[model samples]
Target: MPVTLEEAHELIARAHRRAGELGSHVTVAIVDEGGHLQALGRMDGAPPLSAQLATGKAASVALIRRDGAALRDMQQAWPALFGQLDQVAGRPILAGAGSLLIRRADTVLGAIAVSGGQPQHDDECAEAGLRGLE
Candidate 1:
């Protein structure tokens, strides 16, 4: 199913709540299948850099339609190609704040990326948000 604005809002809200519970502020970004930004939210305490990273992560997932971790692994296995990817917008990054592809029944609707906390915390927050979609 295509991601609706309401779904995006709920994902954002869930991410916000998870961030608060984890005691970490974060920036959350959602993008459509075409890697277009659908929604973005930056918590008050989140670092400015998170805005870019979050957006990039979301774009990466939307474009690749794969988990960010798998992309990272691919990059690690081929540094040359990965370096080339760096020159491109919405490739992949090692920043690690839970960037993921949003899927429903094998259909990639979009992506969600979170940043500004520990990598694991970011993943947790993103996962929490994605879970709300179900």
Candidate 2:
């Protein structure tokens, strides 16, 4: 089942809090099973580029059903396959602070992406939000 709007809002709120705690500003994105955006949050100080990056990362994770970074590594290992992946409508996964896959056991529910801060900070914020869902 897809994540509800309320759930998405809570997750993004948690992410915002986490980013604040870490002294970072971030952009958070939630994408549904079809890789369509469900919600987005860009902290006041977050960079403008974070919006698109977060959206792309979330879409990539939802579409691939895996961590965006892992997919990016796979793409690097197989240029031909991954090269074409970038053109596959949400294939080339973006890295940095934004990009996470949301799953329940073996079932992938959706994805979340966070950008605008350091990579580790972004990752931690994303993780913190996901943890709230549990």
Candidate 3:
């Protein structure tokens, strides 16, 4: 089944909880395998642009079926190609930390990303969100 609202919210909550534990505010964005937004949650003190950053990160991972770290590496390896990706994608494609794919068996369920914190902190929050899935 595709990711439901409840599942998306749960992911946001867990990611937020982890962010709090790390003493950071963050925005969490969940997107379906098709790179469509499912749900989003931004903490009280999160920066406004964090919402956009999280969404782009999540979409990048969902669309490519690759984690953010790998995408970041590719982005670094091919700056010119990644630089022009926004035009090709018709949306910002941010290849950064804090993004991950949600999977069941060999199938992808969706993707999640966290922003408004250090890259490592965001990565941790995203991992925490995944751990909460049933």
Candidate 3 local Cα displacement, residue 45, angstroms:
0.5
Candidate 3 residues 1-134, lDDT tens each? 65789999999999999999999999999999988999999999999999999999999899888999988888889999988877887888888889999997788988999999999999999999999576
Cα lDDT for residue 51, candidate 3:
97
Per-candidate TM equals 0.91, 0.90, 0.94
List model 1 lDDT by residue over 1-134, tens digit each: 55898999889899989999999999999999988899999999999999989988888777766777888787779878767765675455442558888888878999999999998999999999999576
Candidate 2 deviant stretches above 4 angstroms? 90-97
Candidates sorted by lDDT, best first: 3, 1, 2
**Model 2 misses residue 80 by how many Å?**
2.6
- The lDDT per prediction is 0.85, 0.84, 0.92
What's each prediction's clash count?
0, 1, 0
Q: Pick the candidate with the highest lDDT.
A: 3
Using alpha carbons, what is the TM-score of model 3? 0.94
Q: Candidate 3 lDDT (Cα, whole model)?
A: 0.92
Which one wins by TM-score: 1 or 3?
3
Compare candidates 2 and 3 on lDDT and give the better one: 3
